[model samples]
Target: MDPLLPRPVQDLGHYRLPSWWTPGAPRWRQALWLLVGLPLLASELPGTPWRQWLLRLFGAQIGAGGRLKPRLRVKCPWRLVVGDHCWLGEAVWIDNLASVTLGDRVCISQGAYLCTGNHDVRSPGFELKVAPILIDNDAWIAAQAMLAPGTQVGAGAVVALAAVASGLIEPGVIVAGHPALVVGRR
Candidate 1:
């Protein structure tokens, strides 16, 4: 197996799409996403009410009453499962190189980054490791917060603005600063 491939591909003998489409699919999916999805989402940005329809049309598992703004980048919409009453703010990136599950009522603020892929240079060629991210219900990830690969944010947690979390953040807690350690909570 080629070490240049993703870990899943190397181990499973199959290839997933380039973080923007379904596995073994073509570039057309990505194009359609850009053309159709982007336009629809953009159109609904100013509370136009068309965003939900567009996201559902593009195969996002968005729950009822969930509002997603335009410019919300989703890498592989198929790998995303967002729950009910959630709000994904403008320019929020859900870079689901693997599966990313957001539980009910999760609020991913503007400029928040949820990334699930990394490079493993230990291999012959630098291989990619794409893990899943889980953000539990009622979580509030502030602006510019970064949730790194394989991270799990528990329910009702608050990741402060500009914070970077590469690991798990406990439930009902508040995390701030670089590398995102617990600051305080109730």
Candidate 2:
């Protein structure tokens, strides 16, 4: 939330976005990405390179030798940067209101959600809040896991399935559970 342009409303019905609020791109571009992604790029075919190409066209900086599987949903590819040899599994949702960076050899397993946006509950309007997420090299985000905003997953770390991770995760650690506690080391 922008403290500079905050709109404190008395009720939820009266809530409105701050004048400075923007989706970081034109509405048309956002629609176009959906049009291309849902129909073509997200297809359940054998064209990983084509999918990556389409993502690149939408301003995603994707490196080589990566596989983005079917049903992956990337909200605003312009805010995304992925490195080489990465694997984004099926149904992975990257709800990036801010930047999301994934280093080389990172694996985001199926149904994992990477959210760069949240709401400030303290605000009257439940104001939008955003922060960047950085997953370092060789990190493994397992299936159904959720990475919250501002999460910095360290290199070679493993976030176990269904774990919800936030803040900084140390390198080579294997984390599990709701808040992602340290279970082992890679």
How many times do residue backbones clash in model 2? 0
Lowest lDDT block of 10, candidate 2: 2-11
- Local distance difference test, each candidate: 0.80, 0.90
Judged by whole-model lDDT over C-alpha atoms, candidate 1 comes out at 0.80
Tens-digit lDDT track for model 1 on 1-186?
A: 668866532332433434542342257876888777765564435662566666666666778886677677776776788899999998888888788899999999998999998766464444568778999999999999999899999999999999999778899999999989899994
> Pairs clashing in candidate 2?
none
Off by over 4 Å in 2: 1-10
Assess the local accuracy of residue 129 in candidate 1 as a C-alpha lDDT between 0 and 100. Answer: 80
- TM-scores for all candidates? 0.79, 0.89
Q: Which candidate achieves the best lDDT against the true structure?
A: 2
What is the per-residue lDDT of model 2 for residues 83-179, given as tens digits with 9 covering 90 to 100?
9999999988999989999999999999999999887777777677889999999999999999999999999999999999999999999999998
Q: What is the RMSD of candidate 1? A: 6.3
Check candidate 1 and list the clashing pairs. Answer: none
